[model samples]
Target: MTKDFKVIDEYYEAGRKALKSYVTGFVLAIFLTLVPYFMVVNHALTAQNLVWAVVLLGVLQFLVQVVFFLHLSRNSRSHWNIIVFIFTVLIVAILVAGSLWIMYHLNYNTMSDSPFNTNEGYIPQ
Candidate 1:
């Protein structure tokens, strides 16, 4: 029947689109990964710039995996999954940021030149 044929065509189209999305995502992820690797391996960027570049590429790669591999989108019917994922990401980001902030302050406050370090005899001239 025509209806059956139409359904098959729709499925085929959907499959083709999914395949394209996966392929595109894969290529983009690979390119993003390689860019950072090459930059680091070749020492093309200064330390600060390299760190920023790698962070940016890592974020992009995460997005690519989420959108393509995880099949997350605004139009998805299951909103709960996306909501949970976002919540998890927020929690993780908060934890990581807090940890980094704590570590940085500790390092800055406890440096050899700091009054506390010198007073405590923790740092030798």
Candidate 2:
């Protein structure tokens, strides 16, 4: 029947689209991974800049996986998926920032340069 043929065609098209999306995601993921790896192996960037670059690439790779593999998007009918992702990102960011802040303060306060800071008084003036 013509109706059955139409349904089959739609399925075929969907399959092709999904495959293309997966391939594109794979290429992007490879690129993101290699760039950071080379940067580290070659010492192409300073420690701070390399860290930021790697982090940025990691985020991009994550996004590619989410969109292509997980099929999460604003246009999707399940709005909750995107919402949940946003919430997760927010929670993670808060945790990381809070932890870093605590660690920095702890290190700063513990390494006091006061007069009693271990053998300073005994050293030759």
Candidate 3:
């Protein structure tokens, strides 16, 4: 029957689309991972540049995972999930930045040579 054929076609199309999506995501993830590892193993970049590269790749990998594995999208059905993910990312960024800032300041202020540090006097001048 035509109805049966239509149903089969729909399923076939859906399966093809799902397969394409997964293949694309897998390839991208593999490339992202390999590039970073190669750079690190070969010392292909300076320390600062390498760090940035790895971080950027990591972010890309995360996005790929979200889109492919988690099936997140901008569709109305997934809008709430997107919003929540963004909020969570913002909160985590703020927390990490604040913690790093505090640690840097603490280290700087507590250095042995800092005149205002109470412990500075205990060290032999």
C-alpha lDDT values of all predictions: 0.84, 0.83, 0.84
Instruction: For candidate 2, give the lDDT.
Output: 0.83
Pairs that clash in candidate 3: none
Q: What would the per-residue lDDT of candidate 2 be over residues 1-125, giving only the tens digit for each residue? A: 99999999999999999999999989998998899999999999999999999999999999999988888862668698788889999999999999987766665556555665453223322
Candidate 1 Cα misplacement greater than 4 A, ranges: 110-125
> What's the distance in Å from true for residue 78, model 3?
1.3
Rank ordering of all candidates by TM-score, starting from the highest: 1, 2, 3
List the RMSD of every prediction in angstroms: 4.8, 5.9, 5.3
TM-score versus the correct structure, for each prediction = 0.82, 0.81, 0.78
Score candidate 2 by TM-score against the native.
0.81
Q: Return the lDDT, model 2, position 118.
A: 56
Per-residue CA lDDT of candidate 3, range 1-125, in tens? 99999999999998998888889889999998999999999999999999999999999999997887677872689888889999999999999999988866666555466567554224432
Stretches of model 3 off by over 4 angstroms after superposition: 1-8, 112-125
- How many Å off is the CA of 82 in candidate 3? 1.2
What would you estimate as the lDDT of candidate 1? 0.84
Residue 24 local lDDT, model 1: 89
